[model samples]
Target: MNIAQLSGRGVEITDPLREYVDEKLSRLDRFHDQITSARVTLTVRDVKNAARRNRVEVQINVPNGIIRAEESNADMYAAIDKASDVLERQLRKFKTKFLKQRHEAQPQPEPGPAEQAAQLGEEDGEVQPEIVRQKRFELRPMTPQDAVFQMEALGHDFYVFKNMGTDSCGVVYRRKDGHYGLIEPK
Candidate 1:
């Protein structure tokens, strides 16, 4: 497991903390050996609620997707532990689905027209649904803060916009706890 990046925000990371984080994250390799890289961010926010001030965010890159978990607590160690637990569960779930897909029976050769008709006429056959609606809109480049405002103005749970800083696509969404979260490609 390559720890691609580890940084702190609004707080300096001490050697002990860094080592602790590395130890915790290294154990994740047992859950998903395909983890290509991992990025960790430790942040200390000056918020009124001390219990929600310290935050730990972990992003792990796998073969086809990224697994992310964020947790906050009064103590940074506690936050890291919670985030690691979340990542462990997500990785297990991902591995299960991946193995299921990999072990499924392979598709057979195309059936002849008569066989196709017979299969289609089966009484218990199921049909795939088609898209029922589509919409197109212009994506404006803006800051994440602006995107959050736009999302709220439109009464939407999420908004997508081009991040002006990185010049990349980003999404800002409202979390269940009323806080906003941003998603950007690495």
Candidate 2:
């Protein structure tokens, strides 16, 4: 498990406060033992729209996806409690979804020969020819950041290239929020 914290410029966290956070977050182990890693990031934000509100955002990223929990309260402890509960609920949801999908994993039947032949032909009784075109591109090894930039320059949302760091082919893409995301082979 990994934990990182970055509070806002004006926010201050004492050593005791940090310890308290660790204690509460450590309880996540009780819910998921197979959780390979838990990344906890704490951030503080000031709402220009609402000055009186307290804003604390906690983001947890595990193997499947990211679970974000944000809360605002007059008291910091209350905010933390609410955020923890949000995370717990999100994890529970993920657990339930995974089990449900696993139970529904069944193989589909292949198309019959008659249907396949009709699909390969056209309505006018014309047989489509195979081997339309062939093309190839050179792959360059680079870091994830460089690959993402290349993808943007090429007007593509995603790009595949060799990862110089891990010696594996990886995919880099731009997220909807204008942020970068990456996928690496296990």
Candidate 3:
């Protein structure tokens, strides 16, 4: 895989560090051969807190989706190792889910025309919401259960995915009560 090492504030991407990251990340090919590229970023935060200054972030782009992991430690190498380990676990989880879905055969009924009507109506107010930042990524299709797994794996509060069971887009989010909630189109 093509690995790019980026040096963030107060950090330098030396040849040795780049080689080490390349070596560690190359092992990920065994899990998924479709990994297109990997980006490793090194950052040194707050000089006063030396024990957690060295930070490493790894982003791996694969054919289906992207996997990202970050870790901070006293040493840069240690941070890289920790992030790599986390990334490996995520990859394994993703692979396992994909395999299970591929081998499973389930039948789902399609939504009727009346049942698939638009759920949200346009508001008459002139107010418009501001969107400061936007992110674009592949929306992998999976079940709500799988979306919850994906959200927790990424340590994110919510995850958006295409619901294969309904053949529609859905969002799985962590509720305030530590439970899961799923939103889908009517």
Pull out the clashing pairs in model 2.
none
Summarize candidate 3's per-residue lDDT along 51-149 as a digit string, tens digits: 557888888876546688989888889988899899999999888876887788763533433222223245567988789999987788766777787
User: How do all models score by TM-score?
Assistant: 0.57, 0.48, 0.72
Report how far off residue 136 is in candidate 3 (Å). 4.6
Lowest lDDT block of 10, candidate 3 = 111-120
Per-prediction RMSD in angstroms?
16.3, 15.1, 5.5
- Per-candidate Cα lDDT values, in order, are 0.76, 0.59, 0.77
Residue pairs with colliding backbones in model 1 are none
Error of 1 at 15 (Å): 1.1
Which window of 10 residues has the lowest lDDT sum in candidate 1?
Answer: 110-119
What lDDT score is found at residue 160 in candidate 1? 82
lDDT of 1 at 79: 95
TM-score of 3: 0.72
After superposition, candidate 2 runs with Cα above 4 Å error: 6-8, 34-52, 106-186
**All candidates in order of lDDT, best leading:** 3, 1, 2
lDDT-best of 1 and 2:
1
Q: Higher-lDDT candidate among 1 and 3?
A: 3
Q: How do the residues 11-100 of candidate 2 rate in per-residue lDDT, one tens digit apiece? A: 577776667666776777666554654444344556677654555576664443345677787666667777777767766766665467
